[model samples]
Target chain A: MAATYVSYFGFVIKSVRGMFTGGPRYYAWLSFLVLLMAAGAAAYYRQAVLGLGVTGMTDQVSWGLYIANFTFLVGVAAAAVMMVIPGYLYHDKAVKGGVLLGEMVAIGAILMCLLFVMADLGRPDRMWHMIPPFGKFNFPVSMLAWDVLVLNGYLLLNLHVPGYLLYKRYRGEEPAKWLYLPFVYISIVWAISIHTVTAFLYTGLAGRPFWNAAILAPRFIASAFCAGPAFIVLVLEIVRGWTRFPMGDRLITFLRQVVLIAGLINIFLLISEIFTEFYAASAHVASARYLFFGLHGHDALVPWIWTSISLNVLALLALVSRRFEQRGLVVRNLPLAMLIVAIWIEKGMGLVFPGFIPTPLGEIVEYLPSANEVVVSAGIWGLGLFVMTVLIKHAVDIETGAVAKNN
Target chain B: MSGGSRIRPGDVKRRGFLKLLTALTAGAVTAPADAEAFDLDAFLQKHFHQMSDDEKRRTLQRLEQDYNDKYERDDFTVVADGPTPGVKFAYALNLSKCIGCRRCVHACVQENNQHRGREERGDQVEYIRVLEMEKGSLDLEKAVHDYDHEVPAEDKYYMPVQCHHCNAAPCVKACPVEATWQEPDGIVVVDYNWCIGCRYCAAACPYWARKFNWIEPRLPADEINPDTHYLGNRPRYKGVMEKCTFCINRVRKGLNPACHDICPTGSRKFGNLLDKDSVIRRIIDHKRIYILKEEVGTDPSFYYFFD
Candidate 1:
């Protein structure tokens, strides 16, 4: 028993070390990511010494790029379910192989989500306030507390299941049924919960009229279903081009179909939201108006919203059409790529910013994130990319049998 | 700026953190308030409710000493007090007499020891947001909160909004740590020492009544409101949320809030709501009063009426 445990422990240590020391390309990319993260850490240090006041947020526009990114990344993290539901629950052969990739993506996205939240916090040091038994956690009421629970929970599930599955695969053993399959099933439901709770975070706010709507949860879920799997497909296609990761075209195409249906539904929900706002013709629609058009001659977001709509339509058309796929690899992938960008824009500026446009007291204070805020945001994004790169490297190494001696 | 060498306990959260969490089992996350002139007692003080009376006294004494040393002063005292029994506070603003001079706004700033967003950086954080409304109607969409126009313009009426101290205070519920809560006297108070400064309460507040301290609250030592309450008008650190406490320091002591006392037009009237003889009770019984966004059902103590 002791000898078996020792061998397994030695293997894990060796694999982790091997993950760090790879080819020059791996080292160079990691170095680039580390440098970006360091720059971000330095910027965060300044922000920590100062306050969130250093950012462009004010009493009028309380949340900015950091929050916007957080909201978007939550959807991205939740998107892991698009694959998990089909793979684990439905037991579809086309998608089961790629479930680990979806989880790795979620792990990265959720990490970014947490980092953005810390960046936006005024006193991140006081973060322990959310944990129970020490600080009073306003749970079951505060949507944000719900968010804290689900985000971390989802991350843990992803981390555990992937690590366990990877270790089993490394040792050429099937995972125990009681151990990981139950979590995969739980994750399927938890993915929807994570995004739904995130939507509640905004909609629950009676103050922000822009976010206070019943359609918000469905809207968020639809967009997330589209954005998350679509991102996975984009990553898979790109990764396949460079290495032998063993993902099938059938799975990639199946994911595109999921993105297509969800994308169209997301568009329909948006149209319904826009119609409700413009048709009602009430003061409550002021935020929607500010988001779609300009409010009080402050139309900073006009182009951004239009660009999002344009990309959504274009990407939808490209996805539904088979002509692009018939042409070549680049042509076949264009729609999927466009759809990913479309969702990023829609979720980032299109969704989060407009809520604060016509401040609750009816003040029009235009908010554009300052340079420091931008640098801080980019730094977080770069950190997210770095996490993805390293995790994916490990995943590819395990799958391709480069790290496992027997395979 | 509040008088200081600006020498901060920048690493205050890190120092003596293990000691503070001696009561807590897990110590991964913590909120720290560090000062350059470290007093071990103040830095490691327990939560407000958890503190013993002796601890509270020591905390206040240490706070006073810390502020005096950090801000370079000798006369500073941080009082830890609470609401008077049998008193429920209420506010009534006479819209008919309001001229939109923004006096209450500036008055609250000076009285509350708020961060002076005085410079052109547009960082000034204030509790009161005076809305300029059309003379004949209240259209929030058209009302401007940042108008710099002269007071009492020919075609407009002014409405200054601040914390309503609602009976069903959403901000209190929205607080994850109960940092902000409704006291027995009906004023919503924030325990500055305990707040994590998440600002969720700010978003939950319908009136934008809550304000976040984006930077360390600075008041020129001379301008510091030395006559302060722990939950009201106390000098605050950067990164916490504060709001109109109805000046608990003064009102609990039989004195008027600074904004109420400074109003030139007598537009702002505040008194105990439960008192049958109080002016606010008379206004509610006899005057046609309106609560802002009453559809949301916050049941605020503050009422706007035209007398």
Candidate 2:
């Protein structure tokens, strides 16, 4: 089945590459690159000239889309570690083919994380202060400093481990089998740590009662696994469509099982959050009320949250159903798309906005990212995809040994 | 405008040089002797003792040079010198008489060097919130101060809340940067330069006394007060946090708070807690007074006394 899958995909790729011959696809890729660079230049110019005010953020909502995207991307990045560790360290042959692809996802996700952090900083120039002594970042005390250290460490790990393996393979030297094993274990634990720490950034705030739950970090991990695996599944389908890679339906079924478990955990964690908030009858319950219904007179966030909840339920049902998971194309694709959108809305506005409602001053200030913010975000995403495209192209070339065959 | 040798000492005529020197000599010789003999160190020492004699002299010289270059007046400096030995500062408010006239608010802005911004768009000057209250209810739960309607409304009594200068301030405790600290006199002061703008202190303050400058504060140069304290408002940079210092710069200098002094009804009272005869003490003894969020055990130095 695997050999047949590879040969059939190879035939399609050869035909397409022969017809294109570095023409239309190349131009299309170039156009995307131009669009990305233009958007980045515009955003950079605006930020340099007008300061953070160009981002549509105010004192009331000091954070905007930058932070929400940061949170979401960190979760996605952490999920890559799970795939790498299980496949390589534990010798899970079923998942081994995904190990390289998982690292590639981390490379793109971490870049997004860094960009988001840069966008949110009031003095992006002062980011160098995170370096050491002169800047006095106040380690251990500030969760931000910890996030900076861990994220960079993870990026370094991904870069060196994968680059070394690829280099050895290119030289026709057999790579050390055990070289990636230890890193894989570390990566697994590190993956869970990244999302936990990201969640810690919000939950550690004692003042923001909405985020002060002990279950918050666990919930973050569960949701990250659910959305991250689902995204990987979608990427697998795209890879299958575009290239000669032999991805098996059985592997897709396994990924669905992972998603189903993650979804169940995510739903359970959210239920626990609701239970605690409603049961406690504390002032903190005010935040929950604002999120689910409305507080005082504000209702902007209610509809978006309900939609996330419904989509999550629907995705969970589809993913757990064996027939639905195995179904070709449409049925399998719908659940993955639904999970991604559900987590996006949930982690983006649903998670952040409620944490600020009934604000410290008892004001309900609604937040909406401006047009510039949205455009800049889109540009960042395009840049990530551009990087991903180059990476996948390189990986496929190495794996196939014939650039033309892969193309 | 030249390639090196165009302008030289020979470019100026000898006659012009001599005339210029003569004018300088005349100006120097005939200048006010008192101005030349100014003993600012001696005078300033009499007022501000915090500085050592050498420090005083250097400060005096720096001040003269600064003034000579640009004597842009309206350089208001609120004094922040420590009080006379046995004095312990305290404040009390007569909530019953506060008419919500905002006279105290205006006075605070001026005295504390708060930059004025647009009424609708800019940040508030001081850290005081004048919450309107109900006649029969002291219960904050029943308080109708958070009305969506515009303010200066009829049938409401105002209760102004500043940094209670809490004895157990959450803001002081939560400052990871140590930018904010409680002074011996029970006032919480922020080192504006040291603050990282993390907003942790702002979040911890239950009274919401702190305000973050999300944008650089813009004050027209003419309006910039020349007299500045480094820790108080000289001119804060963008992103740092600031709050009311209870007119620390003034009250520590043995002057009443600008807000108390300017109150039309004398609703705000400030005095030394150690002095039994202080008017603030008399108000505390004679009237019904309350500190906000008292149940939280912050032990605030500020109080609201019923007239």
Highest-lDDT candidate:
1
| TM-score against truth, every candidate | 0.92, 0.76
lDDT (0 to 1) per candidate: 0.79, 0.66
What pairs collide in candidate 1?
A125-B30, A126-B31, B1-B218, B1-B219, B1-B220, B2-B218, B2-B219, B9-B34, B117-B124
lDDT of 2 by residue, B132-190 (tens): 66676564333443344555467777777777788877677655445577777767887
Model 2 pairs in collision: B75-B226, B75-B227, B79-B249
RMSD of 2: 14.5
User: Taking the candidates in order, what DockQ does each have?
Assistant: 0.32, 0.07
* Candidate with best TM-score: 1
Candidate 2 structure, TM-score to reference: 0.76
Backbone clash count, each prediction separately: 9, 3
Writing each residue's lDDT as its tens digit, candidate 2 over A1-407 gives: 99866765665465345323334675698578768756665655444333454455544455678778888888888887666766776777767776677778788888889887776654454444445544444467666667877888888888767765654544456888678656766777877888888888777666567877788899899988888888877777777767776566666677777788988999999998888888876766887888888876778889989999999998787766666755678776898789888998888778876676655545556776655567678777777766666666555555555444323
Tens-place lDDT per residue, model 1, B21-132, is 3412232323333323334454444567777898888778877877787667888767867777879999999999999998888889888887765543445667787888
